[model samples]
Target: MQIDVDPQEDPQNAPDVNYVVENPTLDLEQYAASYSGLMRIERLQFIADHCPPLRVEALKMALSFVQRTFNVDVYEEIHRKLSEATRDLQSAPDAIPESGVEPPPLDTAWVEATRKKALLKLEKLDTDLKNYKGNSIKESIRRGHDDLGDHYLDCGDLSNALKCYSRARDYCTSAKHVINMCLNVIKVSVYLQNWSHVLSYVSKAESTPEIAERGERDSQTQAILTKLKCAAGLAELAARKYKQAAKCFLLASFDHCDFPELLSPSNVAVYGGLCALATFDRQELQRNVISSSSFKLFLELEPQVRDIIFKFYESKYASCLKMLDEMKDNLLLDMYLAPHVRTLYTQIRNRALIQYFSPYVSADMRRMATAFNTTVAALEDELTQLILEGLINARIDSHSKILYARDVDQRSTTFEKSLLMGKEFQRRAKAMILRAAVLRNQIHVKVRGGGTGAGAAQLGTHTWAHGLVSIAVPSPGREPGGADAGQQPVPDEHQHVRVPAGPSRRICTPYPQLPALLEEPLGSRPRPPAWTPV
Candidate 1:
């Protein structure tokens, strides 16, 4: 029998969800002002939800800004949240005296008026789109669709805005129009929290010939590229691909990063910095983050994040992590960065720990703990985990409180590898010799009787003895293995002479008959070549 357990209920399988921000040192007015449109209201609402200290202030800002748009539903929702937060503040033990100010009453008249206005505008846009379609003008029809999308977006109908924006794609007549349609769709997709759709449209916008061929030379194209990169970075961040997200954000052009509708320049710096620190190695951090000319402008926007990256690169782990901790509250208040804060922090800490012990043969657990600002037991646990994961080639002595790098026997390893290579060479050489012998002998299985049965098969061999005999035979006047000045007597033509075949054997044959044997075949039977040894 198997018991099914919920992953969320299993501590080991569950993700870290302790994302809360308290006491953020953010200037709400300045931060909110950096963004416009739905982005500002949404970011404020998110900050209000996660941060208790700034709940009422954030909600009040969102409530006020939301009124400028025709999103009556969101206005009511923000007001409701503001009222709750105000009541909670009043009931707190350290509550201040009432300042004689209350949240503004629900604007029913404005709500009704805005709803009617939105409906009228939507209908008018629909009518215009139909008229454009009837006229069969592609550009006008595309503009009509975009106008409808804008109207839907203003009224906080993300679904309808997305549909309208996507509909414009079919009517696009040029690369610029297609890019515009894709950007509109991407914006709505982001607002809808549809990250995959955002990434898809980002890719489409980037792949357009106007953007791809023009590169970054054109100011207008550069701005669009920056927006595309930032959107892709957010999608990658949401997907938990920290390295890819870092690369995307780092590619964004600082001067052209004016997409306040999505994120601020300061956000690019923070997101790119933390991601680079978490995933990039020392050389990559130095070469890409510290020395990058384009991204330096972005880094200048967030000095704190810039300092954290420098500190981490300089091997100042304790101070760097401390700064990160101090900034956690503010980062958690961010809508995009909040969910990944804990995971990124953990990865950065782990990378630091791994780098700390990399250059040392052995290190004391106490010193490492102090460097990481953690307890000795915790440090030991982390080291053990790294060792198990093969990130660190080291071992620990529990009683001694020391971690030692494992010794590798290079000489034995080298000898073993050489032996294996030698064996392989010998095997290959033997195979080559066998193959050459088969080809030299012309040996093969010959099939007879035109039959497929094994009984009809016979071995056939062709001797290459004629060429060997011709090369081995010397001139008749000169004796084999004898100097020209030798005084040895020559045997008579009819007499049998003993010729040395080798050191251990001799053959008796008439001197004149030996030359005749070399010119004739020996009875069509396979035999060894006649020996004439030196």
Candidate 2:
């Protein structure tokens, strides 16, 4: 039988051919039709394990082999074993048995040359299609470019595949074509690990408005959108943007994405539920993840994520985090999450804290530490971060070892208002006292300057309860002025304590003979400080 070999596969290194059994003249019908397919699986698995670049191609070949051999007239035992081997190969390539046989190693230089040639050929095809003038040819040309993109993608050449798909989109006239192009771009970007590009393309396609409305009516459109959203969710999850990832996953339709081969049904449940738990409050988790309609479908695929979330919902936070920790290996090995596994663990810890403390106004540090399976210092650090970011309105009384929640209610508002009021009143009162002293000095200067009977200019006057006593002092060139002996000074209600307006003037005082403040009004009285006895 003629072997159906891939064009890109190099000769001289064909896998598993029994040289002894080769006879050029032998009847082709005597050979097994399935032998080559089975060998292909082994070669792919071995190559994939040895070279990560071949992993995607290996997976696709394995899928095709299963469909062709199993669904047809293949033996049940053989089919089952093949399927199991393929699964193990795909899941744990490194661990697959070599069966005492070695496959040919990949030629890196040849691969590089082949990849370059393929890209050059694709570019030529794109140029030809663009130069062709016929409108009827556009659709066929678009499909050609699209098929080229798919081929490149199967080869793990994502960058070129993305370019081909973008070219295909330019010629798309049908709604179906448009949606497929968008999905293709998203798929290619996902493999490239270009998360921002994936998001950009998804948003642009979704914003078409017709997409949502059409996605509602057309099964194909609906399927594309579902897969698109799921892809975006995975990208967001990989970036540690848990809340956004949760929203995208929750909104995605499950009918189109519950496949074991595509983003596995298990991953959806794990990513969605974990992200929801991380970002949402307890009530939000109940409403959006557990009680949501899409959740019912997603959970059916993988109940583990749902179970972990439920445990958290039940306040078994320690158990939930422990379960996640125990499953760390599984999570870390995930295709989209490998880079962010540690961040995911961090999210789990933070979520646990939020969930455990939601119902309580404040929790004791020691008790919280025990509940979270963490040390007191670490717990304090976490709480401190949460508090500083305003994620939690609480404070730690370091001395008392009490963590108290700040009151955000009306009573607290009133307390704050009272504090502000006291400060404002004190400020205004101090200002008023200073202003009064300055004004009284101005009046004293004016009164003394106008007095012709004065022996000296009075720079200040003290109004007492008995009377207003203006003690005039000698001007700079004159003698000291005294109170009139015949007329006892009467108090002026309009005037208070006065000082000279001139900046050079001073109010002299000898401590023992200081004036008595009995005549001063209580609120306006200037009393010496407690340390300075009158």
Which candidate comes out best when scored by TM-score? Answer: 1
Clashing pairs in 1: none
**383-436: candidate 2 lDDT, tens digit per residue:** 888878777778888766668877779888899999999999987775565455
Cα lDDT tens digits, model 1, 107-154, are 899999999998898889899999999999999999998999898899
Scored by lDDT, model 2 comes in at 0.60
The C-alpha stretches of model 2 lying farther than 4 A from their native spots are: 1-136, 215-217, 258-262, 397-401, 407-409, 412-534
Any residue pairs clashing in model 2, and if so which? 440-498, 441-499, 456-473, 456-474, 457-473, 467-491, 468-490, 468-491
